[model samples]
Target: MIRLLIADDSALMRKLLEGIFTAEGDFDIRTARNGNEALELVRAFDPQVVTLDVQMPGMDGLTCLSRIMIEAPRPVVMISSLTAEGAEATLEAIELGAVDFIAKPGGAVSLEIDRLRPLLVEKVRAASGARIRRTLRLTERVRHQIRGAGLASRPRPSRVSPSPVAKIGKVGMKPGSATLPGLVLIGTSTGGPAALDIVLPQLPADFPWPILVAQHLPASFTGPFAKRLNRECDLDVVEVNRPMPLKPGTIYIGKGDADVMVAPRAAGVIAMPVPAKGSYLWHPSVERMVASALDHLEASHLVGVMMTGMGNDGAEAMKRLRLTGGRTIAEAESSAIVWGMPGELVKNGGAEAVRPLEDIAETIIEMVNSCAAN
Candidate 1:
């Protein structure tokens, strides 16, 4: 049986969650009215998973998550309101070790309860087996520290460059690659939602290439994230399913358990799934996406963009793009919330260019236009 602790300031919400999980069966439910009570229950119940609300009296959910992770380390799912402040705080919780989050349903009790049932249950199941840790190293400190010193913030290329375009053709193109000029592969995590908000909306509707994104998010969050992105961007943003065809001006988000890969089919471009066992530390591996794009698309036509994220998930993949004659861009540190992943790529010489979030869309569009003209 799975054990769960539901911590919320709302008695009604606590009861509703209890009913939903109880109806699902196999759950030993525990409830807490506040973060302090939740911590007490954690010591006694030792539940396998926790569903914590971000706004509670006294200690907030993020503080509770930090304490829980340090004291007894267990997977936590943050329950947040749908407001902007709530979204920002919930994202902070994820960075603090919460496995995922569920937006609190609004409106009538019946409607809210019904909408959250499936998500609450699914997150509990996913969190029950997750590996929770108390601490993670932040490696981008050196880069941030160096910038504070008056040294040139951007790394100077060892060799003097005549022009930015001079390095363009040094990476040779592969045969029979896809010829679309607007398609791009984007990888992001940690602070992705905010960064994506800054980046995606800047893309023009006529942007020719399809976008394949691998954001480190759990299953339930992906739908909401896609919906949010779709509303913000001019392009059609949707989560990719098994055998879904990739189309121009469309954005495909990788599913939680599946590694999304692109391959040319007789009918056109299709997003396919690979088994999950060998996927990198994170699910919906970025490496799988980048390598798959390299294998299937003509290198000259591919543009890989890595945004603000934790860990070095996209570094090696970006290196492969550099070797494959594809353009690679990393989010500049000043714009990145965490900067671990992109910082690693920039440090390792994997990224061809480093730019702030605002410039990524324009840079990508320029690369596509340049390749098309060539």
Candidate 2:
């Protein structure tokens, strides 16, 4: 049975969550009306997982998450509103040690609660087994990476700070720059954002290839995440909300609720956002993105890097990439928040190299240089 705690300022919400979990029959449940109460119960109730609301009277959710990480580290799933402010705060909670977040539809309560129920339950269940200490190490890793890239700030060791590289100016790519030596395709979910922080900031601004990412996220959250990445990484990052010309040194993040694909255009290859395909299970679908890239570019001119995520979204497409001469890398199990996706690649003989999160950037740089040399 899973021991769980639900913390919110709303009595109705607390009761609502309790009922939802109770129906599952295997959850041992507790509730708190505010952060203060939640803090006390964390020690007393000793839950395997926690559901924390972003808004609470007296102390906010981010403050509570900070204390929880320092005092008794465990997996936490944040419940947030689907507004812009809520997305920003939710990302902060992720850096502060919350394993994942589930956005509350229609503000704190809504008719959409029924639709969100399964997602909320699944995330909480996933959080129950997450590695809290891995998150701490990741926080440290990103800080060290930023400092090496000349963008360091001394934030707390366990905290994911606001854009450590925000002061670094972005470099514009010359249109029609020499054929992209290669394009890097990264796919992740679950612990992806923090994992990205460790890798993207490590690459220099003039790095040869453009990067495309397919991270599973909701529509409301992806825009904020892309903006956050733009500030934190030296590479120019933008959400692919429209057809954008592929540019070297830029990172294209697929817009949430839609898929991003690369295809040939009269001017050049453009990365464009398209409606999610019905066949794929996850949106900003990794499978579709890699398949699309292969349809237009040589497999040898592509590199697939699979990072921390919960399912095998990119495994098959990338397997095709490697079999056809493309280079592939999987995040070593040691550093993955969830090994499901990368593990699938490893099992299926897709990855040419399986590297830890810390080594992936260097591996990418080396592979890109080799691809260019060829």
Candidate 3:
């Protein structure tokens, strides 16, 4: 049986969630009325996975999450609303150690809750078996160091050294070429936002290539997430809504509920969002986006990165990129929140180099600059 806990201030919401999980069977359900009660139950129930509401009374979701990470340290999926504040909190919670999030549909007693049944069930199942990091040892200084200058109030020197597994190899590009490949494609999920926060801010403001990112999130959350990233990153970050020319020193984030695709236009390669089909497991699928870019751009012109995420959505596509002479980097297991995505890539012989999260930006910078210099 899957040991599960649901924490919400609304009794109706808690009951509704309980019914959903119970209907799935093999689930031992426990409920908590608020954050304080949730903490108590966490100690007593010892559930494999927990679903926490962001706006609970008596400690609230964020406080409860911090406490949970500090105390019990289990996989947690946050229940968030579609509002901007909810999106911000959800991102913060993920950084704090939550595995994923489910957007609350409608209100506390919303009948629209049915719309979230599929997502909730899937996320809960994933969280149940997730590998969570130990946050108990992260002091304020350690956190600032791990997350880089992006999340902290004070400025610090960025580290850009290569990891033990990083391969500093030669790019097979000729010198003095007018048209060189200058597109960076990054795909991540599960624990992607936190990884992005670390990497995006490390790139210099004059980075020559345009970056396209596909992260699994809700449509309402992507914009706010991009804004958060923009505040810390030296490059301009925006949520891509329509077909726009790719620009240097800018990062384009795909819409949460859509698949990001690239096409060659007269101006340049432009990114746009396509509505996700029902068959797709990952919204804004990393595989679909990278594959689209591969169709139009040469492998040498692109740098493909697979970060901390679940499943192998982009692994096969990354393998193809490597075969065609593209530079590929997979996030090392040591730094991954979940190593599924990058692990699959390495298993399939898709990656050229695998580096820890802290070294990824430095490796990318070095690779891009080398290509430009050659």
Q: Model 2 segments beyond 4 Å from truth?
A: 107-110, 134-179
Task: Provide the global lDDT of candidate 3 against the true structure.
Answer: 0.82
Q: Candidate 1: which stretches are off by over 4 Å?
A: 1-52, 55-182
Give the whole-model CA lDDT for all candidates, comma-separated.
0.73, 0.82, 0.82
All-Cα superposition RMSD per candidate:
11.7, 6.1, 4.8
Backbone clashes for every candidate come to 4, 0, 1
Which residues of candidate 3, in runs, are more than 4 Å off? Answer: 107-111, 134-180
User: On a 0 to 100 scale, what is the lDDT of residue 24 in model 1?
Assistant: 86
Better of 2 and 3 by TM-score: 2
Q: TM-score for all predictions? A: 0.59, 0.88, 0.86
- For candidate 2, report its TM-score: 0.88
Residue 285, model 2: Cα distance from true site in angstroms: 0.7
